[model samples]
Target: MEGLDPRAFVLGCSAIGAGLAMIAGIGPGIGQGFAAGKGAEAVGRQPEARGTITSTMLLGCAVAESTGIYGLVVAMILLFANPLVGKIAG
Candidate 1:
């Protein structure tokens, strides 16, 4: 780290932070998968309410996916439009 310039260090850390941000995606992935499985199970038990169950499951999945989208946005900003590099370096 001593040999690295401030810009390089900031950029490297920003990249790592971006990578860490993407870890938030795992939660939504797992939540959606669980919701899908439960939806399937519910449908199997109540075939008559398939439409209702499907809609609810989709809504839940959409809500769950928002966190992943936020993570992606944060990662993208860090990777492509990092303001910290300039602030810390300049």
Candidate 2:
């Protein structure tokens, strides 16, 4: 058989890019888990400070969410912008 068609090649690159983008999820998962554990420990130590601990935990989690957002942006770029297509076309 002949080599892949242009569309097929673009699709293959998109698939690879999607996989790479998903890998970024790992960072947020680990970071959020750590933040959750710390929040629990803090609440356990000072029951009266539960509110503060919860707020801080949520803030940290929100920060961790940024990594996932980055991943989504990358995936979107891969699916939409698809820089590799330009190279292939050239």
Candidate 3:
């Protein structure tokens, strides 16, 4: 590690972190898909309640999406704000 260039190492780690962070998207995708399925089923069983079911499903999807959004923020920070690089220089 001592032989490695600091900027290169930081960038490499940032790439890895960005990749890992993107994995967070999987949870929201799965949750939203499941919610959509359940919503469809509920709507099928009670056509009159479609409005309520759809709204509830949308809310759940939004809540689930927060995790993915956080992951995106982390990735962006790692890529752009990379405090590690500055600390290494100082």
For 18-90, candidate 3 gives per-residue lDDT tens digits of 8899999999999999999999999999999988999999999999999999999999999888877777764
Report the number of the highest-lDDT candidate.
1
Q: Is candidate 1 or candidate 2 better by lDDT?
A: 1
**After superposition on all CA atoms, how large is the RMSD of candidate 2?**
2.0
| Model 2 per-residue lDDT tens digits across residues 1-90 | 277598777878798988899899999999999999999998889999999899989998999899899998989888878887777653
Q: CA lDDT of 52 in candidate 3? A: 93
Query: What pairs collide in candidate 2?
Result: none
Ranking of all predicted structures according to TM-score, beginning with the best and ending with the worst: 3, 1, 2
Clashing pairs in 1: none
List the candidate 2 regions with Cα displacement exceeding 4 Å. Answer: 80-83, 86-90
- Choose 1 or 2, whichever is better by TM-score: 1
lDDT of 1 at 53: 100
| Cα lDDT tens digits for candidate 1, 1-90 | 567698888888999999999999999999999999999999999999999999999999999999999999999999999989778734
Local error of candidate 1 at 50, Å? 1.3
Model 1, TM vs. native = 0.89
